[model samples]
Target: MDQSFLLMLSNLLHLHNHLDPTSALLSDAHSPTSTSSSSTSSSLLTSSSDAQWRSSYGLSYPVFTTVVDKLKPYIAQSNLSLPSDYAVAMVLSRLTHGLSSKTLASRYSLEPYLISKITNMVTRLLATKLYPEFIKIPVSRRRLHETTQAFEELTSLPNMCGAIDSSPVKLHRLPSDYNPSTYRSRYGYPAVQLQVVADHKKIFWDVCVKGPGGIDDAAHLRDSLLYNRLTSGDVVWDKVINVRGHHVRPFIVGDWCYPLLSFLLTPFTWDRTGSPAQNEFDAALMKGRTVVEEAIGLLKGRWKILQDLNVGLNHAPQTIVACCVLHNLCQIAREPEPELWKEPEESGPPPRVVESEKSLYYIGDNLRHALADDLYQRLSR
Candidate 1:
């Protein structure tokens, strides 16, 4: 087994290693390889006096039930009698437990491919329904500024609309008939790329779902509608241009993984000499961008499906997209405190970056400052 997989197993089994302590449910309940086929499938107790052992640790049952209820319309429209509710529950359980399909098949007395298919089906339902509802743009500039101001206080950023980044979700390699480029990864692992823009609220604003594993965050943006909206109009600075055409594009926030564009904001580097005020402003901007990192971290933390490689299915691309949508749903349902986004007033300035990484400083500082100044002028105007 690879070190990463071993580490994951260790982390999962080593309950005390985590900050939030819990009893080893999986260990007590069943072995990872145990066949669920032989077990009695009676109605399990709905209520557990043990507050700690709620369905999937309390949220799973409600989340699955809500999802199933929403999916009923689709099931009715499609006239399919397939057990979508069970399928949804199975998928969530798979995600929560990080069990292999073979392991799951044995436990549920279902075929391995069927487990894969059901998981994919549920994800598609999620992509169609849940994704659009959870991810949305801020409708007004006032709302945008207020959102930015909130992040600014937290991360010392200004005129920032949101945080943006790309994360890799590993997938099992399909047969040779599938496009070979799709499964390639920088680390030589099979994976897929997802680009997301998260607002100051840490809510996903816009999402792009079809880059190959090897594509970096920058490459994904180049192909996204978000990037197209940023490069359309007359040059503001030598590098900045307006790209918003017929569609109204909100100001997007990303890290240094993107090129200089009018609508996006990033951070600053050390070597780039700027006015102290400008540096302060860039510092704030980078701080706000950190929320995307946090959002991605939270997403991966909840869905171990993203942590390891997924292979064997024919519909890998669709599954990858569906995972992102489901991730957003999980975020919304979990509804972490808004106070999580609030910048602490007492926090001091961020630590400086090392000199060796100064080569890319311009990318962060220039785009960040230009966008900040533009938004300030726009909002002030």
Candidate 2:
């Protein structure tokens, strides 16, 4: 009944007010709520053709089949033999094409409650079961070396491991009782931030889904396990890679929104104010950091539901993380990028304030200057 939910419903129907697109779907979806607890469980098929397969769920027949096969073990039950496949298809109905639960219930001839249940079940599976195997940061020395080589090739900077960035996924404004202020975003709605780390290939290696879309990137990253391990020196990097006599640490490149550290390198400045050498380093760093941006682009592009999370706030983090897991899966499956995918305008970063860690801050500044001068000298030749 709230304005935000109404907005979501209006957007979902997208029908002229005169047209009652919901009458049939809603009546059918809510039928099970009646005294009769029985409803026919028929297959979902509109007169729409194979094109609907891709358009409705962002999966071709073959890919859908493969997903079914992969998820069968976790979702199979005697009450629902191919439950996993149906569950996956149900979740994708919203993720790929942004169909509401009522609309999907009508399409599948199932109840709205059942549709919600299936979607939640499948999302948890992807987030918990599949995430471990697919969404891992390359820790092995050989794997780290490969990722470093890839980043170095892209930016002409050595020992680069990954690009980091955060994107806000829009969500329905929470109920009045739910403290909506926590979810407020720059986009004039509630949202949750999806922080990601990606390689040159635009595959996400790490995802942190802890932000309420209001927190700054620096705070979010600091709270992440990635930061804890990196600072604690728990993650092992290969022997110091000497780049033209400069000791390069295995580091990830971020934008000016993040703080620079021995292991996490951000640009010296956003504007071109520094010396040519420092400017050159910033240019290369920004160029390489685009990988995470592009990765997020591809992610939200493929899963349109993330464009507006439409799901409950309790499920927002799980849903975003699940989408990342599925993104990696699709990339692994060699699925082609979705055509006509448009990247959403990301929220601007807040002005950074150095709270503490002055000693390390100075060290980071020295490292940036050194790298910039080194790169500038090379470019001069």
Candidate 3:
């Protein structure tokens, strides 16, 4: 037997003599009342106060309890007897609080490796399993109509599906063999670009995490499955709006870094003296796109793990996706958001304009102009 295993065995025996033998081996099926799992939901898991629990896990007790109820079955494994709440708490502590595995082990009497292992498992599980259930872009006309109306109310643009943007999640540089330069962001650090499409509610319907930080926003979005679906006509924005005799499909608004598509709108350029209609169009479009910035801000604000990314490079991106899942969950649960989350200043320059087929680009530009004209007319009225 390994020395550590023998030591664990000896400790188990001695520990069980004083404590209940069965309690030491936490079972997945154990109820909250079970002695082994009793401490799983305790605020003292890492802190003494409920405030600590909320700040550390990014969810209140009621919310956390509901989440753990569902996680019980999914986290079950034959060899591992780790309680479900313990698994969730461990993962959330790392994610929401950004506590390191070593520190968690020291505080919780767990093996540091075990802490890391559980965090990764739960993160990947949330990203893979829970993502589809919670993160969905409404394809239904009713929901789309409602969302578009909401955006129009806010900014006077019709058939606006969502706002798209990319934010940098700071990370350590990968090995040169892994193309280190690509991960080096214009922010003067290694990062992964997290692309998100957020609705007015600050809920993300599409999240793409494949791009490295050095790439432009346009390249990042173009490579995403969301972009493919939109361009390839797989994700059909069926509700087309008529404005001043021009028919416009439901579209997403983005910054100048993104190219204008019939399904994606970008602001028009303005010289020192620009037209009133063009300026109003840009203003309304930006107001609509502000949701993405707020969404990313809330995401990073609520989950501090993305602030510096303490996890390994391979797992960092998945961790970010997991955070997105949790963010939507919290938003749905009506969890109280911390006001402390602040968006970092945009240190990178705007992405270069990507060349596309002129036919669609012109059509998109015309639609944009029409929408701007429509909004300008609305302001005039």
Predicted structure with the largest TM-score when compared to the true one: 3
Clashes by residue pair, model 2? none
Whole-model lDDT, candidate 2? 0.70
Which ten residues in a row are the worst by lDDT in model 1? Answer: 338-347
TM per candidate: 0.66, 0.81, 0.85
Q: Please rank every candidate by TM-score, starting with the best.
A: 3, 2, 1
Question: What overall lDDT goes with each candidate model?
Answer: 0.54, 0.70, 0.75
TM-score, cand. 3 vs. native? 0.85
lDDT of 1 at 325: 64
Candidate 3 local lDDT, 223-314, one digit each (tens): 89998887778987788768878888888998877877788888785231458998888888889988888888888888877888887778
Write model 2 residue lDDT over 110-214, tens digit each, in one string. 567765776777887788887888888778888888888888788888778898988778875565786577777756678788899998778888999998877
Error of 1 at 27 (Å): 25
Each model's backbone clash number: 13, 0, 0
